[model samples]
Target: MHSKVLDRLLFKEDPVEKLQKETGKNVNDVHIDFNSGQTPQIPSQRYFQNSNIFINKHHRYSYMPAHTHDFIELNYMYSGHCRQYINDEPVALHAGNVILMDKDIVQKIDYVGESDILINILIKDDSILANVLNTLAQSTSLVTQFLVNASKVHAIHNNYILFDAQKNEVAQHLIDSLIIRGLGNDGSNAREVNLLLSLLLNELSHSIEAETHNFESGTDDLLQILQYIDQHFQTVSLAGIGRHFGYNSNYIGNKIKAETGFSFQSLVNRKRVSLAKQLLAETDYPIARIASEVGFSNASSLSKLFSKQIGYTPGVFRQRRHVLDVPRISRTLES
Candidate 1:
């Protein structure tokens, strides 16, 4: 039994379908002017307004070209089934399934019939997303951790997670609430929407049936390796991790590069640099000590890599961050 709101939104002949019926023109021939790139990049500004989140029904009866978007996208199979390709891999989604895609992933959708009701939920603002992730930081769910890592600006790869929520009543109900909140335009605040989204993700995180799909095989092993690196980056070694995972060092190294587009050492350095920045911003640790804590042999090594990665020395970064934080600290104290 569909909710009244879902029924109202699902069965309507949307304008795009109406235009296609009346003029016999496809959607691409109608109003969508894609970029001239080999894989057309869709800008978030095309769909986003003042809010960080936007929801819309997928236009039916058109062959969507292979394209990428600048924002995170989640597609919910509201009542029917559809098929799409992500990174040249075919994925079939049925009713009550959900697919969450990170930014810049190549995707294409097949033409759908009138019964297909796919809903698009675009997350346009990274800041808002970061806030949501922060609220879920304490979660130990692999899905939560994967999302946190994937959302980082320095993420090694773009990926997607598919949830089989067809029989999950909680997930379906939350999806309905999100659709209603997103489409009603009833003076609902962004915080409410964020909360609902947060709850939905948390629920999905706990769903044992949720499946993760990646562009390559051996993703489960890769995720395990990544998680191990994240936990022990300050002291992790390629040889040690290989031994731990029962693979040869050479094989592990090649697999890491093949799956993540980065070498094992590069991934470790990224993690160390990230921690170094945090220590510089929030603590009074000396540069040498911070370097040692983050796995650099000395301050000079950290400084060289920091300059290469961040365009400045650690001292300069710390001083700039302090200068930027003074006003905020003063306001906090006054309040």
Candidate 2:
């Protein structure tokens, strides 16, 4: 059923490149020979920069350094087993199980046996969602950000795909169907692709809930505040946002201060300043432009607020960022 995947990985640019000085022997030099029929097709996004997936039935490889992706990820094990070093947590998963990875998750995967049979789905916040929604909604919902709201999140929400067997079976089939449809649906209905994506999102939401903390804040009000902060990061004002949400401005402000250990304005201001710091370090744009780019109406506002929070001007903040890279506190404790 997934012969297409086999063809795409072999004789193609192997994103799973073997390291020069890895502990195991070099596997890159060995050429794959398929004299009987076509190898198979892999997901096109698999070869895209910063994204790839392979279903390794009996493949083996040397270790790669711990790395991270700027996109959500999912891994399902069909057979065999492997140990994963996910940030500070090390976990082992066998067949019929899976893991949902947050975008900033840093981890390394190591197969325990001859080869690991697994399928990976990598979703970067790109046209992938837009193409699926086929609408102008560009994922601006606050409820779905903290919690997965299937309607907004799913490409096809009203229906679902059927697996009727293993957990691995459904995810694998759905991704494979999408890959084929993406290649050339020709003019056929996209029902197959739509159902596949919706089902995949459902599966992933389950995985996320299972792995993450079962968080239930004493009051839903705190969550509402978080949503408000996320939604209006650019032009969010503590008083205005609080009033708009139907609470007295001071009451809302006090609630935020008590629950989160920060005043309402402080939380939203931190968000803007934090984003500004990122743009400053990553881009070569001028300070005035960077300030305006990060939602400050004027450069003076960014400078004043940045100094209050970070104790440095934007220029000096960027300069000290490289020098003052904070050592991972947990690493120190672990050592």
Candidate 3:
């Protein structure tokens, strides 16, 4: 399925060799010093430049010794299979698997098969992630946990998350778009890449939330309720939620209050506001579009609620949280 995409993006020069030549060091030499057992040279500037995101094809063979990087790494298995060691624990990865490796997570790759086609997406900055994390702060899904842990700054942690996104079209499209746009010679628009990556993360969050909802436990009623709200806060009503859960509307409200110490409407509003904030911070969509996207009836209603809840108007929020650090490129993407 992804083979055609890989073929389209394929280059004659091997990427691993390209990186090795640019750095003037073999891949193995970049890792731990045998005497010190410490990684002395971190390839902070090789994978990614000043831009927060980097995409490249993985072309390495032989056993890769355990090493850590200063940037977060997303290993997308475009085809074939391989086994990896994350923090000394073996993990088998098949085609269509995407592993999220947090910064400082010690990892080593085993010998790759001849047919393997792996793509590497490295994130060199955390500011690109702040808005995405803040938007999905309410979620407790596996993806959310991975993002939260990856965003942390502690250097002593070893963490990796596997997302079985084989059947997800949204993820596949986003990954392909990222790879294509990144390979373009239009001078590497940082803002554009960040927005595309954020959209991908947002889609992954929804995918995990849906998976969580499908496999929910009977004892975790609050979790189920929150998951429902997370996915449908844009169009969900108290009565609608009650109907889906087989309870009366008033009873549902009372149950949410009892379990979470917050009213049903309050919880819904909070989730909606979080989405609005993310759209405002990460994209250049108009206020009306954002209001509609987050489930408000109109921009006025969104404005009233946003100002009342957040102590700031939506327009002001957008201006203050604007993420395009490059002002010149901001205008280009905003159009």
Q: What TM-score does model 2 achieve against the real structure?
A: 0.40
Q: Which 10-residue window in model 2 sums to the lowest lDDT?
A: 156-165
Off by over 4 Å in 3: 3-5, 11-36, 39-41, 131-140, 154-156, 184-187, 206-335
Q: lDDT for every model?
A: 0.72, 0.49, 0.66
| Tens-place lDDT digits, model 1, residues 30-148 | 24456555887776775666566777788776657788887778898997789989888888989888888877789998877778889988876443323332344445565555554
Tens digit per residue, CA lDDT, model 2, 1-335: 45656446432323343342255543433233323353322223433442222222223454333555544455655556677766647767665556655544566666433345555544444323222232112233221332222212222111111121244555556655655553323323233344455455554443332343223323345555565666666777767776778878888877666644556666667667756765665565667877776678788999999998767898896676546552211212111
Off by over 4 Å in 1: 29-37, 128-134, 184-187, 208-335
Candidate 3 to truth, TM: 0.55
Pick the winner on TM-score between candidates 1 and 3: 1
Off by over 4 Å in 2: 1-59, 112-114, 126-172, 175-195, 204-209, 213-335
By lDDT, highest first, what's the ranking? Answer: 1, 3, 2
In terms of TM-score, which candidate is strongest?
Answer: 1
Per-prediction TM-score to the true structure, in the order listed: 0.60, 0.40, 0.55
Question: Which rank order by TM-score, best down to worst?
Answer: 1, 3, 2
Clashing pairs in 1: none
